[model samples]
Target chain A: MVTLKQIRNSVLIALWMMILTFPIMVIKVNTIENIVIWRWMNLLYIGVGTVILSIFWFFLINRRKLEPEERKRSFALKGKIETLKGVLAKPVVQKPLYAALLVIIIIFPFVSSLYQTGIMITALMYVILGLGLNIVVGLGGLLHLGYAAFYAVGAYTYALLHRYLGLSFWVCLPIGALSAMLLGILVGLPVLRLRGDYLAIVTLAFGEIVRILLENLSQYTGGPAGISGIPRPSFFGIKMSLSTAMNYTYFLTFALVLFTIFVVRRLEHSRLGRSWVAMREDEVASEAMGIDITRAKLSSFALGALWAGLAGVFFSAKTTFVNPASFTLWESVIILCVVVLGGIGSIKGVVLGAIVIILLPEYLRAFSQYRMLFFGLILVMMMIFRPGGFIPAKRRVYTFDKAQLEESD
Target chain B: MAAILDASQVTMDFGGLRAVNNADVHIDQGEIVALIGPNGAGKTTFFNVITGVYKPTTGDVRITAPGKETESITGLKPNKITEKGLARTFQNIRLFQNMTVLENVMIGRHCRMKAGIAGAVFRDRKTREEEEQVVADSYAILKKIGLETFVNELAKNLPYGAQRRLEIARAMATEPFLLLLDEPAAGMNPHETRELDEMILKIRATEKISILLIEHDMSLVMSISDRIYVMDYGLLIAEGQPKEVRANPAVIKAYLGEEFNA
Candidate 1:
């Protein structure tokens, strides 16, 4: 089943995305614009029209071609419908997963309304961060223990730019992301020479250095107290403030979550993704096969940092305040746990892991100071019992094709 | 006959010990040659030196290919050496265990993959077509080596004999003009050894790829090798055709003991 909600969200996001890109577009469209008279407006109009027509054509074609059987097959191949049906069709004893997801979805909206939106917003931000780390640690097998360093760079970037330069939050987001990505490559290059546990140690060291630098650079980074009263994301002429625009923060968070998922999903199926996996499985063999190991490793690091930076920018905007405490090494460890707990390379697993690792501890807050005890125990138990996490990639069975069999005979 | 591979005074020293002391050998085009010796006599070391896994302390290793002049292979990286019409299989069966047998073979054709990152990522029509061709070529190699059925199996899961054959299939995937097989029959049973002999002959005849093999099995070596070099104490003691080398006094001393000869 197609999700109208997702499509509608995509449209909203696409418009906001185009707005963010306006500066570059304006610069590139030199001599062809009257600012607002006919040049830029005509391009936007034509682009939107083309996008709508293409989407319409695709939906119409698929609709026409899909028979009941074909529809079922396509859904079976790509959708969650079959998975949901499979879960529900199981014995009552085995149907806990179906009931559990239902409960969470139902509870999420109600909980967001009742409790502080801060916790929920924070959780959503981590979901994006965890997914980003998953691309490196889970898929690439690089074991990047310093992912939080990139997060710090992003938050610090947005915080400093908005505070000093008076640049809008929207403007700082991409700049922060770019800064984080460049730093990611910088860290990735030196550590690429190391392998496995060594690589982890080097990254861990890198993270500490970044934290120490921020703490020491009082003039630039605001030392320990950190930057405060940072602006929130705005919609048109309206600001996402507490009294009138609280819901806008949640909307912006959700939009980011959706966008992160879209890009990551595309990346997972791409050639670069396959190369990352190949490198992870066997580096010697990967290099022997003509893959430039250095290039693949650097790209993973860059993309992973880019994700953290984007998440950090959103996080600082959402909080309207930033401190060193918010970007601690423990935060990096927590993000790492989410990716591993989710089953490394599995996208759904990472999302589920981020939700559970974050929200589960919050739910057990009644236990108070003992919450840490329960969280640690749950993590240990999960590692021991379901090491593959909630989902694992299936191993395919190889069989000979008929013509080849005939030739062999 | 033109020499496909020429090694002059190849020496490898490990600390104070000379592992390979000034060994010189030449391999003719389309010939099946064997380097035979007792354990730790530096046959494998010589293979390593010639294949660019180890740089010889002092030597020149050159390969003369058709329409191409003799090129120095010494000091080149293994993959770079492979691109220069030379490839090798490992003694311990270094197949990428987690990758499929087909993928392991496809990796050998990695240098041949013309698709760039963009093409590979998007699976563009040209890349897709190229990938299909690679798969076909890999499948064909597998079929020739009696491993077509195991094409999709993980390399680690194959039986001992098939794993050895898979290594050969993988090496062939690189389309090497000169193939090096390091202890190809190291762990094989007698029946498997006989089959490998037939397989190697077939490969030489059909593929037209020269074979430089290191084998411990004397019977297999004597039967299949066009010429054999016998080494003892990191020095070449004998070199000639199977019958000539097998009967040589030094080879007999190296093999059977002086007590047996007396």
Candidate 2:
């Protein structure tokens, strides 16, 4: 039986939720009549629903608090979840799962509509950006708040090159990436000594400076009006229409994503990768273990920017336009959220995060006005409940038998 | 015997306070030296100075490798100093908590191995072979340290004693000619301390690496150290063979205290 205090608490929670949801749900606009209307029925529905949900939660929480048996049951549930995770992580299960995912991704464009294909391209672009940022933030333990600046550098590099010099997309790809890398080095050199929040603020300021320069340099960058009529990449001199253009961009991005996965996977197991992990865990100990902090920090910045540059090239080619507004602080925050919400260091997690964050808002278009609010609410809830992400990165393990060591010797 | 590490007249001042003042210390090839003093004696500060964590305000630290010329390594970066064949373990165990035990050791092999971004990303045959070697060598070190059983476990998950051993194993993987240990037995039980003593001896014998440890445990210091240096107020008070250091009045008054002499 629920106590008097439990009932009161549930009621208070219901009242609080009502106050919060009233503005969005109960308030409505009659555009045709040009009048504001208070939808009382909606308020009643929310109040009733909240009261029921709160009472259920109170019972669940109070039972665990009052009974050792309930607490034990919860512990058992957690143990089962851990066991399930272990079982899923085994090679026998993982190999098949990976194969299935590969097959699904390969066939996605063919099965989906043209609009969906466009969305997939956008998601893949964020995936590349997320993976790049993961190296600096997740692996190197650097907080970068202005990562979108590199993306801008990549996009603008392609836009300006094509507009002035008439450079082809294939020719400009590497050049764009190189420019970003150089900028990364330039920015990293001055701020490599700062750690944690200080580094983040500096990077944020750097990002803003890049955007403002792009805006004010109207003669060179086209300023706030942005550059238009940027040409789409052609397939071996084949002129493309709208439908074929969508497919072309999809395949291009797909190939890039696969290459990214391969590079990131190899780097994760390499000597350099291990050094990054060490530096992230403990900088002082890492230095004592002979990791050159300066080299490692600089390399992380350069390499992370490399992928962003590539993605930026694709973003321009896909849209056939470049704008200062496209590369904003919000863009950086979203990409960061994709990295963190998926699983910071996990490639699969980042991919999943990019897809979810990108696609969920698109699907919630029926609630167009409230989509961002809903997205914000979901993100806050995800942070509160699963801070490690939807899929946390797995730790690497090595096992060797005594006989193996002897044989190697 | 050649002096592997020779820090002469080293001084470090933070504002008005002198942390390490006119400190001179040296470790001979294959010798096990101990630096002992009371709390706040600047033993760690001296270790940091030698390891290139801090540039000394005055004086130079010279390292002479076997059959090589003595090189003044003062003001070099810590990693550069480590690459010059001097490595150290922290007084507080600092393992890469999230990484596996083998990975921790593999990181120590970082300076020895040469693989840039291109090699790491592309996985050339040579890079692959080098990585395999690193793994094999790290596993071998773990076996010697008796932590092979926990090789796959996260560094944070290891027992306190094993974490301490892992730190040593990591330092050894750097292929240092001289290993500086900062209070390695700080939180160890008697049994763990004894195991550490034996391990240190084994490392010295097998790896041929000289050891310079700052230890507060008197019994362990007395039993294992070939030579002892006593420090107080950032200055070396006495230096001699263990017996002489034990009997020295200056060391007794400053570190061991009057009761120990009695």
Candidate 3:
């Protein structure tokens, strides 16, 4: 059943893979002596490996083609798969799945190493930031390229307040968030009228301005050196050690992520949320529908800034350091990437996007210099295959049958 | 009958090119008036001026709400004009294409509903009750327009005629005292136009809402409209009962080579 044409195609694929890997496998740099060396054994191993992999792949693909009953079997298999999916999707099954996930997350830090916990904390911080940006870009359809400016404002607000006024983390949290919200409004007012690329450019400039101001105002902020020795958030007046502080901050960010999810979920289903969707779909028509476009845009900006502010406070407490270099245009771009890579309007997608974007780079550290190249390749692949993100938002569904049943009058 | 909308000396000049020149139009309570003209007669431009889409170069647009004093609404925002009980539909159907039919109507009730961000996030009892009321009211409006069957369908998925009706249903959700419709029967077939005529009459009779429409469908206008105003080159040339306007020489000249048999 293995056709001559199929075998030829597999051989060609094997040849391509061998050619692609030849340079990497056959040549090596002698870092210590600065000399080039040839590795014929490695090249041979790669060529053999590609040949074996292609043979296996072709065998799997050709097996179904060989069996005439495979088509009918697959149709039946698909039906069974759908039934299994329905069962798994039932509320009874889902409730337990959620509970199990919660239990695992609670015990994860205790079981995992300290380094793993640190990585998790970073991922969770991005999750909060991603959710905040999702409100503006995803729901409100406003492209903000300078979201990290608000993040910086929040971090510095807490840093300066604790440094000058001797305020505790608990006291600085609200003030830092409010300050960021105020700045969000101030920056949002004039630029809200501009649409698309123009709005994006103005916001990009605003972010750079904040960074330059922070750097030049070194008498207060420490310039490139940054402020260090910022106090950790104490738990019930007890000072935490390095490991304990990691766990505490992890739990704190976990709770905040849950809160963000809850608030965003509610907003998505509420009147305000609907108005945001309306604005996203058609701005002029939304205004004619009696929605105050100015109010909606401003509120989205403030709310988005509020979350970023909270995340900034947590960032300062965890690192116990702050600097202008820490908040950059790159930071804003990475956070935006997370939101876009996650489905823009979906809460779950944003969370998954944050985890993938934050964790994948760390895991690829073994490749060191090649990790960024690999990351770029993966992102390109994902964009080509799943442009809607890891988890796309669900389309709206209405049950007219139920309404008809109830409308007997 | 008391005038629900009164506009005097309304002129709109877009940098030396006059779109509407000194056009005076009015709608009385519960009256169905048709603004019929050939293409580019400033009928829609005049409507935009009244609905606050554009501020006329020189004009005063006043709305007299039932039992309320008349007030100038010339420079107000479109949302503000909607709040003052005047709502208009676009010539092209402007329903939110991605949203459900029910949601499109519920959005029309936005000005009437009072739930803000805090209320929405907290889910207070009052907000919950108001939200329920909005759903019920929106459903009733859909049913009135015979669109209850497609309540869950996206606006883009509906047929052309249904999309047009959905626009009117959405405008009515604001509970306007006067509805301004720009070419409601533009692409409708004869059967659909007949249904639209009956629906417009029913809206006027049951809701007591005045209708001012810009239409090219002569049969629809002649059959349903109580009065007609003919516009030509930004000027109001004739205004009278439908029969008189149809026979007027100025109206005939304005509609020269256009169909007016209906």
Name the best candidate (by TM-score). 2
**lDDT scores in order:** 0.80, 0.90, 0.89
List model 1 lDDT by residue over B117-214, tens digit each: 46644667887788667777778888899987787788889999999998888888888888899999989999999999999999999989999999
DockQ score of each predicted structure, in the order shown: 0.16, 0.71, 0.49
Q: What CAPRI grade goes to candidate 3?
A: acceptable
Using TM-score as the yardstick, the better of models 1 and 3 is 3
Q: Which candidate is the best by lDDT?
A: 2
Query: Where is model 2 chain B poorest over a 10-residue stretch in terms of lDDT?
Result: B253-262
Question: Candidate 2 vs candidate 3: which has greater DockQ?
Answer: 2
lDDT, ranked from best to worst: 2, 3, 1
Q: Which ranges of candidate 2 are over 4 A from the true structure?
A: A1-8, A15-48, A54-100, A401-403, B256-262
Taking chain B only, the TM-score of every model is 0.96, 0.97, 0.97
TM-score, every prediction:
0.76, 0.92, 0.88
**How much is B227 displaced in model 2, in angstroms?**
1.2
lDDT of 3 by residue, A1-409 (tens): 4567766776777678767887887789999999989888886777677766667666645654644466446467756876787998899999999999999989989999999998999899999999999999888989999999999998998899989999988898899889999999999999899998998999999999999999999999988788988887778889777888889989998998999999988887788888888888888888888888999899988889998999999889888999998889999999998998988888989999999999999999999999999999889867865788988865456454466436622
Clashes of each: 1, 0, 0
Per residue, candidate 2 scores C-alpha lDDT tens digits across A145-175 of 8899999999999999999999989999999
After superposition, the stretches of candidate 1 with alpha carbons farther than 4 Å from their true spots are A1-111, A114-121, A168-171, A241-274, A395-409, B260-262
Give Cα distance to truth, residue B97, candidate 1, Å. Answer: 2.4
The digit string of per-residue lDDT tens for model 1 on A1-409 reads 3347645754665576567666665445335654433247644864586457545545644554677567666555545776776766678846687578657744554456635566777788888998899889876889888889899889889999988898887899899999999999988888898989999989988888888888888898788888898888877766434733545676677778878887776566444665677788777656544456787799888999998999889888877877777767798899999888988888878888888888899999999999999999889868865788866543334455778556544
Q: Is the docking of candidate 2 incorrect, acceptable, medium or high quality?
A: medium
